[model samples]
Target: MEAALDAGADMVGLMFFPKSPRHVSLSQACKLADMARGKAEIVAVTVNMDLDGLSRINELVAPDTFQFHGSESPEACAAVKVMQGTKIMKAVAVSEKADLEEAQYYAIVADRILFDAKPPQGSDLPGGNGVSFDWTLLKDLDLKKPYMLSGGLNVANVAEAIRLSGARAVDVSSAVERERGVKDNDLIRAFIAAAKNA
Candidate 1:
């Protein structure tokens, strides 16, 4: 967490879903969030959790924003915002042009949108799958809410990815890892430097 903060990361993602390898327990996540409180925005990433579940997390983690990466409807996203009074970032899985349509639906409900690569069939995880979609698909994307690009991003290709997608922001996970769920300080620094320079 300190490494990411020192690298000048604007936001840090903390998963709440146990199914994800990156998942952190509520107490652990809250502790980390507290540590990064003023340094960086903490995002609580979740799947198809109910309002009660979300309420619990909200009370504990107090994230700056909530990122819905599951099959959450626009109403559900809106409901979460009303309930927690925190910003919401909706993740749309993109494998083809048609998938971009989902962003249109979420623009009305979310504060921001994240365009991530669609996970492989039967994959347990949603985002951070180390899979990338065709960047050209987002070449001319223009939406009411700003969107960030995610998936398969690293120091080597993040600049090209941003150039091709015209993305002002990007989210990376597996690409900077020394192993699954274990982040490498060197890779994190390299990625931040490369992205900023790009």
Candidate 2:
């Protein structure tokens, strides 16, 4: 979290899904959220958590945005926005052009959309699989809502990924890690620099 903030990240995501390797405890999230409060937009990334769980996270982290990375319906997303009064970002898993269509359903309820690679079959995790979809599938995307590109982004390919997909924002995970769940500061800096330069 500190590394990304120091690297001038516009937003920082704190995972709250236990199944994900990147998940953080409530206390850890609180500290990280506090650290990023004024420096960058703090996003709380969750799966299909219930309202009670969401409330707990909101009370502790007070994130500026809640990113839903699960099978949350448009109504569910709207409910969260109304109940929490925080911006919403809905992640759509893209494998083909047809998958991009899902973003339209969320456009009305979500403040932004995040296009991520579809999770591999048999994988328990929903994202951070180091898999990237065909970027050209988004060459003519028009969701109206601001959208971000994510999935398999690294310093080596981020610039091209941004160019190919015409993405104004992006997200990275495994690429900046020394190991599965551990982030490396230098890689974080390098990736941010590369993306910014692009």
Best by TM-score: 2
* Candidate 2 lDDT over residue span 49-140, tens digit each: 99999999988789999999999999999999999989999999999988987899999899999999999999888889999999988887
Clash pairs, candidate 2, are: none
**Per-residue lDDT of model 1, residues 9-100, tens digit only:** 99999998888889999989988999899999899999998899899989988999999999999999999999899999999999999999
Total backbone collisions, model 2:
0
How much is 45 displaced in model 1, in angstroms?
Answer: 0.2
Q: What does each candidate score in C-alpha RMSD? A: 0.8, 0.7
Q: Relative to the unseen true structure, what is the C-alpha lDDT of residue 102 in candidate 2, on a scale of 0 to 100?
A: 85
Which regions of candidate 2 are displaced past 4 Å? none
Q: At residue 5, what lDDT does model 1 achieve?
A: 92
Clashing pairs in 1: none
Q: Give the TM-score of candidate 1.
A: 0.98
